[model samples]
Target: MKRWYVWLGAAVSLVFLYFALRGLQLQQVWAGVRTANYWWLVPGVAVYFLAVWARTWRWHYLLRPVQRVSLRNLFPILVIGYMGNNVYPARAGEVIRAYVLKRRERVDMSPSLATIVVERIFDGVVMLFFVFVALPFTPLPEWMRRTVVLSSALFFGLLLAFFILAASPRQARAVYVWAVGRFVPEAWRPRVTAVLDRFMDGLGCLRSGRDVAMVFVTSVAIWLTETVKYWFVMHGFGFSVPFYVLMLMAAVVNLATTLPSSPGYVGTFDGPGIAILAAFGVQAALAASYTLVLHAALWFPITALGVYYMWHERVSWSDFGAAERARRSEPEVVGTEMRDARQREVR
Candidate 1:
């Protein structure tokens, strides 16, 4: 099943890549790549890491109500997870990160993963802000505009439903048990219910408006800081698109990557980005070149840093394999809350 899914994702990736690279302008693409200020990447990478640091800080806030892990401790786990995401499919790195926390910090896997879900949800909301805020400036195709609006409604609906459930664990508990019980084998209900209890406990932070607000603010900071990286990268190409436009690209592209795609988000990351920049009057070759380099910048530095930390922490491929196995066995308390991706992104 996993191999089948990976192959399917690869097919989707090829389709997106074809769109991203359709025009035969290798000369222009190479010209764009060669006559560039490579030095801009220095600050681009730095700003990217800063955004990641803010993510760590926000995760710290989320995990505090659960087990109180320190940012220092969580940061590497976060990077490792990001690294895993880059190399693996289905963003399995998230699962690996939770597994690592359980191993290193003695945190329970279910709740730790729940915190990641919360992270993704807040990320979705923040990225939506970026999209809606910049919408008036970018004249997207009608199809693209409708896609964004529909997606916004879907994300808002999901968050609202999740908020209501997290805010009322008793009702959530009943709903979960009753819903799952209707399908699960009779003997499995008790174990599933127990997992639901732990999962709800993980969402304890949601009971406070302040905590949600903090998560939202930190999420904005993280994306905006990363947007600064996008801004910096644009300088390399001598393209001076407005910062908000870049934010919109960052928002749309990263959100697109959350969909199933090849490892490292190959086509998924580059395609929408190229399309968006093209819509903004960037020539196709230049847009493709810019998007490709940006993808490399996004995929490489943190991935290398993650590998460094993985080696330092004595984590191995075996550990990676172990994490996948652990995922198959982890309990899903609430069907999609603890089960489905709250969503995804790095920009």
Candidate 2:
């Protein structure tokens, strides 16, 4: 049922994107594309690759205390995961990633997934920080202030929830069990409870001050690199946007991806990118052009590289789909239990 909903949502998003693009004038878009400094795109692409490498390092670093995996082993998997996100909806790339690491590094999927969840929290907090810092510098409209305020409040609320859960495993476990008990069959309750118990164990990595500091630093660096990439793309298009404005734009673009959308964030990402740029005083046509170019800069190369790596790893789209299916079929307890076990081991 969940998988069906994801596919249905993805289909609708894709149809919307197709129509959105069709509505735009081909000549105008071509003119924008033609104006692009193709050479500048090269460096933009390199910066994007570097950003991915940094992100993979951060992910590997977070997993280090529990399981020591080399960056070399993780980077390709990370790229493949991002590729999955572009092609699949509901961000199944995350589960695909946990599955890959589980297969390649003997890492249990649940704990690994817990770390990913933690990483996402860090990413959100950092992005929100950037948005807050950059807010005054950008020429945000009065109407948009409410949107920013609402988003920031929600983001911090989530962060607070993560911190509370991380600090109190028993409480989290109780909540998890309660939620599971509401729907899971009585016959399977014991097994489900055992699985969730292990999953809660994975949250223990946050107990270390050193680990927390390292993860925070890495999260900042990753987002900063992303900001630089966004700036570079704008520069490539001869736009004179400030660094902080680009940072806010980057935050907006990241937030946009969190929305339900088609493969590669098609209309969803582009629309937000253009709107954010326009908020910063960029012209509509140029903003649209810049958004498309930036989208290509970030999405196209990694996707192509992901395909190559997937082939090299001998994993087909069907294989990935099957793995996703397998993951979905597992009782949530399986993941929760494994995570709890890993957290206990880490602590």
Candidate 3:
């Protein structure tokens, strides 16, 4: 079953790859790649790490109501999680990140997972912000326009629901149980409800309106840093796209990557990025060249950093692999036990 998803993801990626490379002159792409000055990537990569640091900062803020972990510690874990996403399928890096946090910081897996969910929601909302702002300026395809509108509505709706749930936790819990009880199997509801409560407990920070605002601002800043990285990389290829265009490209491409694709989001990341750039009037081959190189820059640097930090932390590949398997194989009983163990630690 899992293998099927992998095959399916690989298939989807191939389709996107074909579309991205279709009608493009490879010689031109090669020429673009060969003649480009690589120095700009240095600053691009540096600023990318800064964005990662901002991501770590955001995670730190989220984890505060749970446990206060330092940036030094959290950065690597975040990188490791990203590494997992890059290397593994199904974006299992998320679970791997929660697992690592549980082992190192003794944070509860459920709550740690909750913070990750919140982080994703925040990121999605900000990406939509970029899309809407850029939408008015670009002549996107009909499909792309519909995608942006649907995605915007979806994320905004989720954000509204999240705020409502956070504002009324007690009532939300009742509603959650009632909903879960109606749908979830009788044998599973007890364990499910217990885990759900702990997950909600992790969102304690969201109960404060100020914290929500800070998370939003930090998320926007993080993406802006990412946009600047894109701008720097485009200079290498002479893209000459305005910053807002890159900003929109950053938003659309990153959000597009949330789809199922090969590890590192190969085609899912590149196709839309190139497409968006093309939509903004970049030549097809030039856009392909820029997007391909940009994807490599995004992939290689952070992965190497994750590997370095993995070694620094004495976390072996065997450990990482084991954690991946553990995540895949972890049963409901184990999840409940993990949450119970966390509750005990908190007590």
Candidate 4:
């Protein structure tokens, strides 16, 4: 990650932290944190991992057109990816997961990365669905309403583009060929085309309406599973919000995390979470404590598991940097070499 980008993310976190903590209730917040019932978190954590497993299944489904990796093999990789997201800036865990998949499964990084992108777009769409579902029950602030509008535009726009590309690869390729011919240097054209071709392979699942429907259904299932964790955590803190409101909280907080923030989504996650609950009549201090605990619950277990998996897979910390760098500047050799490997595996 660029130094300035990292610094900028940290700055955004600080600004959000200011909003999340700008009141006079430290004692009450501590009291809420100290007095909360801890037993409820057991079920919450269990349910959270269930969501993770569902995520593994979803990824497995998405990759069917590219490679039919098993759920057992994909689980650890998914955890490690989430772990990367928690610790690294710019969600670099995504690229790390792609790197790991390449190492273990011989999938080309470009196509695998493309699948990951599809996963994110679907996730965004689900989050928007949750937001809209809760909208009638929960009145969002003006700023939040605007945020939802912008997010809807962004997610739907990407979905259409991907659908078009996947559904009409020849047309997409024609455009790509024209662009490459016009803009790419003669020496680089073949390599660029090869990389793009693999990427389109990743989008293969989107080409079928049945497959697209399956993905959407699974995406909804994944988020709903996670929202169960949110509900469980809310009980631990002795706060009461309707299930749909919890859905709203889950939606807004996640959508907020998409903004630039420090690793683990420090401020971006907490600020919106606290704000949402408080808006719904929970005490600010109580909301703050719950959000903090929920954040830790969401972060620590998976991250520790990711570390263990990293060790088990013999992947080092340096690999994270390598993955990020790989995304930025893939070796031209990858264009020719990985493409042939992919073709052989497909055949």
lDDT of each: 0.85, 0.77, 0.86, 0.91
Candidate 1 per-residue lDDT over residues 1-347, each given as its tens digit: 28988998899899999988887488998888888888999999999999999989988888887798888988999999999999998898988899899889987777888888888878888888998899788777798788888888878887887789788888888889898789889766765776667767778888899988988888999999999998999999987788888999999988888888988999999999998888888888888888889899999998999999899888997898888777556554333443343443322
After superposition of all CA atoms, the RMSD between model 2 and the true structure is 4.4
True-vs-predicted CA distance for residue 272, candidate 2, Å? 1.4
lDDT of 2: 0.77
Error of 2 at 27 (Å): 2.5
Model 3 residue runs over 4 Å out of place are 180-187, 324-347
lDDT of 4 by residue, 217-242 (tens): 99999899889998988898887989
Question: By lDDT, is 2 or 4 better?
Answer: 4
Rank the models by TM-score, top first: 4, 1, 3, 2
Clashes by residue pair, model 4: none
- Which of candidates 3 and 4 is the stronger one according to TM-score? 4
lDDT ranking of the models:
4, 3, 1, 2
List the lowest-lDDT window of 10 residues for candidate 3: 326-335
Report the number of backbone clashes for model 3.
0
Q: List the residue pairs that clash in candidate 1.
A: none
